[model samples]
Target: MTTPENSTAPRPIKATGRFMLAHPAHIIAQGFGSGLSPVMPGTFGTLFAWLSYVVMTTRWPEIFTPLNWLVITAAGFVVGVWTCQVTGRHLRAPDHGSMVWDEIIAFWLVLVLVTPATLSSQFAAFLVFRFFDMVKPPPISYFDRHLKGGFGVMWDDIVAAFYTLLALALWRAI
Candidate 1:
């Protein structure tokens, strides 16, 4: 999944200080260290988001409503902008692969959009989101290139999520 947009050249991350238990920003920004994977960290982070979303919705039940998910996603997206900004600055990359708060939260937005989704549909959403995120078509590419800092780091994935939602709606129509 290493595209020019998501270059995989290993950047030397300051592991100890940023990843320490005291660093809440680091923890949230890195998707709890899923981004540290040597391979496909974004994929891992998206999977982590999926599993966490499924678990929370399944276990809590009360907070699984559509309204709640939307509110929660909006809040998380706000936090994610800050997380990506801090981590991107720390890593010195506008959209670093290891700063996977983008992927994790973006996929969560997809999950919320496709709620009550079957396993197949959820899997489809995953593939589509990852594809848009990786390929970054049109405006996605524009945002990725033109935008900077945390919001820029996070915007393309939000665009990808929108694309995924559109795809899902089209799929349902067919």
Candidate 2:
């Protein structure tokens, strides 16, 4: 039996192995594509945080003062919710990996106490903050799990920052 001209079989979709650029959540959630890295996207995202901190601490040290840090941390918590909700809706995905703004803000929160005037101290603080963030022990883990949306995305890192601050304080005291 001959098939009709309009009755051709549908072709199977072949995987193109191409990376996607325009996500529903806009560029922010994709960490400006930093989150799309093949490995350790979080680290890459944190680098952005480090650079931002360096700039802020250098150019606007007064804004990063102890009192300002508290204000910034609180602001981060509030804004994080809006950021997360926006990205979540954009990507149609809950807490997409590309949403690294939260990570940046959270790391900055941790560095508030230990932020050093010297480059070496800044580097040290960055490393320490990264370590604690990665480990996510105790309360950090609790926050990570219990919170939802942007708060959930950012909470663990915030707690990690607190832990790092405590450790740094104790270390300095010794």
Candidate 3:
């Protein structure tokens, strides 16, 4: 017997590069397309940020100073807003899953706090940063849900980075 005309399921919405690029905000906020991964997009975005950290630290250690961290964080805040606006408009939804630029910036911030000149130390920092980000304790969760727009997206991760920094500092002290 032939299936009914409506029996076939509707095709899934395919995420397209053109769709992402329709807005300029998405381009910068998504860390230059690192946030566009189909699977585990946040993780992939964070990895991209980590790789950037590695390069920055190795090639331009002088530029990785505290002042530079502040600058980067500020830039992330500005860019994050645009990212949220773009992704929200494109998806017609707030804080879409595919928009992981905030995570990338947050991971990068965390890296600055715990960064060691050694490869092992960097790996340790990465693991610790991921843990805090995923766990989202206290204020981090609060900010994540309550805040709106790009600020909301970036703030939670910043809190997570602070938490990771504190934990790592304590661990090192002990």
Model 2, span 1-174: residue lDDT tens? 547566555532211112224433345544556565667767777787777777877799877776886787688678767766776655555566656767777766766666454667667767877788778788887887788877688777777777777787777789
Question: How far does residue 30 in candidate 1 sit from its true spot (Å)?
Answer: 0.8
- Which candidate order results from sorting by TM-score in descending order? 1, 3, 2
Q: What is the C-alpha lDDT of each candidate?
A: 0.82, 0.67, 0.74
Across 99-173, the per-residue lDDT of candidate 1 in tens digits comes to 788888889889977945788889999999999988999999999999988888888898999999998898888
Identify the leading candidate in terms of TM-score: 1
Top-scoring candidate (lDDT): 1
Which residue pairs overlap in candidate 2's backbone? 24-90, 25-90, 29-98
Clash pairs (backbone) in predicted model 3: none
Could you tell which candidate, 1 or 2, scores higher by TM-score? 1
Per-candidate clashes come to: 0, 3, 0
Find the 10 residues in a row with the least total lDDT in model 2: 11-20
Per-residue lDDT value at 125 in model 1: 95
Question: What local lDDT does model 2 show for residue 42?
Answer: 75
Instruction: Quote the positional error of residue 130 for candidate 2 in Å.
Output: 1.4
